[model samples]
Structure formats: C-alpha cells, structure tokens
Target: MSEQYPPPPGWSPPTRPPATQPYAAAPAAHPQQRPRQQPPAAAHKPGAIPLRPLTLGDMYDAAFKIIRFNPRATVGSAVLVAAIAMAIPVLATAALGAALDLSLATELTSGSGGESVTTSVDGADIAGIVGVFGSLALGSVLQGIGLILVGGMIAHVVAAASIGQKLSLGQAWAATRGKRWRLIGLTFLLGLTTAVLLVLYALSWVVVVMTTSGWQVPVVYGLISVPLFAAFFVWFWVRVYYLPVPALMLEPIGVFGALGRAFHLTRTAFWRTFGIALLTFVVAQIAGSMLSLPISFVSQAVLLGGVPGEAGVFVLVMGQAIASVVTAAFVAPFTTSVATLQYVDLRMRAEAFDVVLMQRAGLTTSGGNPRP
Candidate 1:
C-alpha cells in the first residue's frame, strides 16, 4: 500500500464509492393529481345570540331563537296574560250586549208609539252604546298594557340569552318588575299619542266637510288628504316604532325620555327600522291568520252544521277563544322578540353595545371567542 500524505486540517478521508448504476431523474407528478382538501370549520354554539352588529336575517333568526331558548318565559307567559286580558273584556261585552238586547225587546213589545216606551228605549240605547264604547276602549288599553309587559319580559330573557345565560320565567319577570310601571306608562303614552293623532285626522276630515261648498268639494279634499295623511302616518310611525322596552328597563328614563331616545336612535336608520318593523308586523299577522283561520272555519262549520241554540253558541265562543289563545301563544312572543332584537341591533350600531355585552359575558379575556 502506498503511504498516504498527512491529511489537511478539517479534512476527511474519502471512501471508495460502491459499485452501482448512475442515478436517474425522479418521475413527475400527474397533472390530474388533486391536492387533499382541509376539513371544514366547526359550527357555532346553538341558541346563542351574537353580540355583533346584526343583519336583517340575524334579527329574524334571533327573534325566533330567543323564543325557542325560553318558551316558558316568552310564549307561555304571553299565552296566559293575553288569554286572561282578552277574556275579561269579551265576557263583559257579551253580557252587556245580551242585557241590552233583552231590554230593547221588552221595550219594543210594551208599546209601539207610547212616549214613555220611546224615551226609556232611547235612553237605554244611548247607555248601551256608551257602555259598549267604554268596554272597547278599556279592552284596548288592557291589551296594550299586557303587550308592554310581555315585551319587557321578552327583552329580559333575550338579554340573558345574549350572554349564554338561561333565564326562568320568574327571573325574567323579576328583571322587569322595576320597569313595569314605566313600560305601562310608555304604552299608555304611545296609545294616547296615536289616539290624538287619529282624532286630529278625523277633525281634519270634519273641517273639510264643514268648510267645503258641496259634497263634491269635500270628496275631492278627502281624496287628496287621504294619501297625504297616510304618508304622514307612515313617516311618524317609522320614526318612533322601535322603542325597546330595555331602554326603559335598564335605564332611569321616563316615557318621554324613552321616546326621545328611540327617535334619536332611529333618526339615522329610519328606512331600515321601518322595513324591519313592517316586515315583522306583516309576517306575524300572516302567521297568526294562517293559524287562526282554520280554527275559525272549523268553528263556523260546527255552528252551521245543524247545531243550534246555546250549545252552538257555546261551541262558537269556545272555539274562537281557543284560536285566540293559540295565536297569542305563538305570535305575541315572536313579535316581541323581533322588537327587542331590533332595539338591541340599533344599540349595537349606535352605541357599540357589543363591547359592553362582551365584558358582561366575560368573553374579552385570553383570546376568548365571541360569536358574531
């Protein structure tokens, strides 16, 4: 073996390569070869209302979702309150009508042209008409108050739900207790405002009729004023239609203050607010009609299907009552939920309430996830 020279520093001795064939280029991938796809993202938690600014779809979804989340507090309470409130007025009105009819029948039979009979009958008719009007007004007021209370309860439940909390009927009611009176006041104030506007509208028509030259003039004025008044009504309603019960419930505000706040909030988004309110009302009405119409038809059929006397009347009344209760149970909660959610959405957009909600929910720490 030949003596090897000393290896250089940081150098290594080369070894003989194994006896093998020359390397060949690797095969290329086919053009049709598809890459593997990544898996889809996980779904969000169910029944949780998002705290971010909402879209119309989000509003619709949240409305029904809140009802689903707490049916006992929302739908059940609505059913019970609405049924009682409506039944009282209906029964009273029916009794009054029956009594009035009996009295009129007796008066008519007593004498055809006697002055005493005519005077007594006229007085009775006037009293009955007044009583009927009073009953109707009272019923409307009671229903409005009941609706306000239900709205408050739903607002409480939705607030709890937005933060992953489950609210019971008692808890929701308790949350509303402090604001119940304010809510009632606000409802009354709204009703009063509406009534005043209606009165003014009627007076305008009366004025036109009284001041005009002839019937044609009054008719022409009415034709012109009708569209104008309708437009005004729509505009006014849109501006003040979304006063959320939460504004009164959570804050220290009175009816006027709440109305001012609602007006201000909706000032910037009038059309959106109007559209949402109109859509909610239309949808709720349609749904209620669809559900109740069948019951009404069935009741009418039963009444006209050879059934007569007190039994037929009883069936008709009970059927109508049942239909009303069922419709209220489903429809009231949904409409209230839409209103509450619309308020929340407006607040989120105007006040950045999502930040407050996030903090309340403890979702602002350590990169915690907040549903959008």
Candidate 2:
C-alpha cells in the first residue's frame, strides 16, 4: 500500500502483571509476601526481531493467537482479502470488454443507418466487440459475488476445523459484521494507491525509452534505472504489503497508522520480510505457470490457427477462463493465509504473545478470547 504516513511512532508494551501465575493459591501469613512462580508464558512465543529459531509450538502459538483472539474473525478476514485480491483486475478487464461488446452488438442490429452491406458489416463487427466486452464484464461481476460467498464460507469452516470453536459462517461475518464496509473501503483505497504507484513505475521506464537518445541508451541511462527501480520496488513491497490488511484485521489503526506500523515492523528485519515476500512471489509464479500460463499459450495458438471463427474464440476464452479461475482460487487463498500468518509472527515477536497462547489452550469461558 506504499506505506505512506510518518514513521512508526515509538511503541511500548502495556504494563501488566507478569505472564507467569502461581502454581497454587496458599493461605499467606503476610499480605506482602509473594508466591514463587514458574517460567513466563512469553518464553513459549518468540521474542524480538532476528527472531529466535521457530519451533512447531511457536508456529502453533502464532496461529492460535489469532484463533484465541477472534476465531471466526481471523479466518473471515483472510478469506475476504484473498478473494478481493483475485477478483479486482479480472472484473475490471471483463467489465470493459463486456460493455464494449454489448454496445457494439446493439449498434449492429440497428442496420447501420440503412447503409450498404459493407456498412452493415462494420456495425456488426462493432456489435460483436461490444457483446464480448459485456459478457466478460458480467462474468467478472458474477465471479466476484461467488468469491465473497465462498470466501466467507471458507473462513467459517476453517476456523471451526482448526480451532476448538463452533464457528458458523454467520458467526464469522458477525465477528466483523458492521465493520466490513469500513475495511472494504480502506482496503480499496490502499490497493488503488499501490496500483497507481506500480503503473507510474512502469511508465517511468516507458518514458525513458521514448525520450532518451539511442546510441548508449540500453547500457547507460535506461538500464541503470532498472536496477534502482527493482531495489525500490522490493524495498517498498516488504515494508507495506501487509500493513493495511494487518491494520484492518488486527487493530483499529487509521490508514496512516497502519502504514507506519507495517514499515516500523520491517525495520531491523528487512531481509527477513524480503525473503518471505520473494518466497511468496516464487510460489505464486510456479503455480501460475502450472495452472494458467501453459493453457493460455495453447489457447493463443489455437485462436490464431485457421479454424472456424466462433469455435476458435469460444475454445480460447473458455479454456483460458477455466485455467485462470483455477489459478486464482488456489493462489489467492494460499498466499493470503501465509501473509496473514506472517503478520501474526510479527505480532508475536513484538508483543510476547506466547503467554496469551498458553492461556487460550486452557480457556473455556464467557468469550474464550485470548487477551488481546
């Protein structure tokens, strides 16, 4: 989300009783005398950046932090984020194409102002284009609605499965029920801002190509900026990728505060975050290649081949659609889950969250909410 706003303000842990509780309650002769204690709960959760080697228990602690705090809410946020991430561009492109096609079809059916056959052909061509655009757009809209429903369902089911919670879809939505609109709006704004930055970054390269001189352009000017841009892109990405989502899901921070918190967490641990992000990218790339890229390439080949017109377009569109949607479904939810996990890891490190985890394991109460 471009991680705008001031640097992360100084943060401090809240003052609370020590994590460890006495093994047993005893009649004390003096009110001032304190009981001996066991090890602190924080020991179970990881502490501070350059995180200590994570054990299986540490990972579970991280996951359970979310589970304990708001079992259904945690799962619901992840699913919603995943679906929207997949649906946005797909819907935009499809809508544009569908609208263009439907408008063109309407014009063509109107007889081209009663002109000759060639004029009618033009009108018909326009109509076909509009129809294609409209259909694709409508397809995207339907896909979005489907994502919202399925994503919500996944959240509830996963929460119920992973945690000892009797969470239903209704409960999951209720966790963030009224606040969904705010989360959605904030997320969209952040996403749009990031996208605009990316577009500008690409356009900067385009500008370099169009305006610069020829002889040494490839090596001297244009290429020099490529490495710099790459560095900036990586830097920006690690710092901000999860900030907005973290803020929306985990805390009540404002947009600026969320961005600041994200970057703040990255400090002293840039390489770690970079590693996670790069790993995510590599995994996504591999999955996309297997699921969509080969199918898309084959579809292009078939579309360009000398075949009956309608059959070629239909085969290409339907085949590619199947490939793309499969990829979307798998990639979106998987990455969203992992990224959300990363956020928990960060919180654990900062907040000594292990203590909370130990407590949740034994909890059976009014809320059973892990102490946030």
Q: Write the per-residue lDDT of candidate 1 for residues 80-136, one digit (tens) a residue.
A: 776776675457556755655323343433355654453345676557656655655
Candidate 2 residues 101-168, lDDT tens each?
A: 32222233334577534323355456555555465566666555445444433333333323344455
Would you list the clashing residue pairs of candidate 1? Answer: none
Worst 10-residue lDDT window, candidate 2:
43-52
lDDT of 1 at 109: 39
Give all candidates' CA lDDT scores.
Answer: 0.73, 0.54
Global CA lDDT of candidate 1, please?
A: 0.73
Clash counts per candidate, in order, are 0, 16
Each candidate's root-mean-square deviation in Å? Answer: 11.9, 16.4
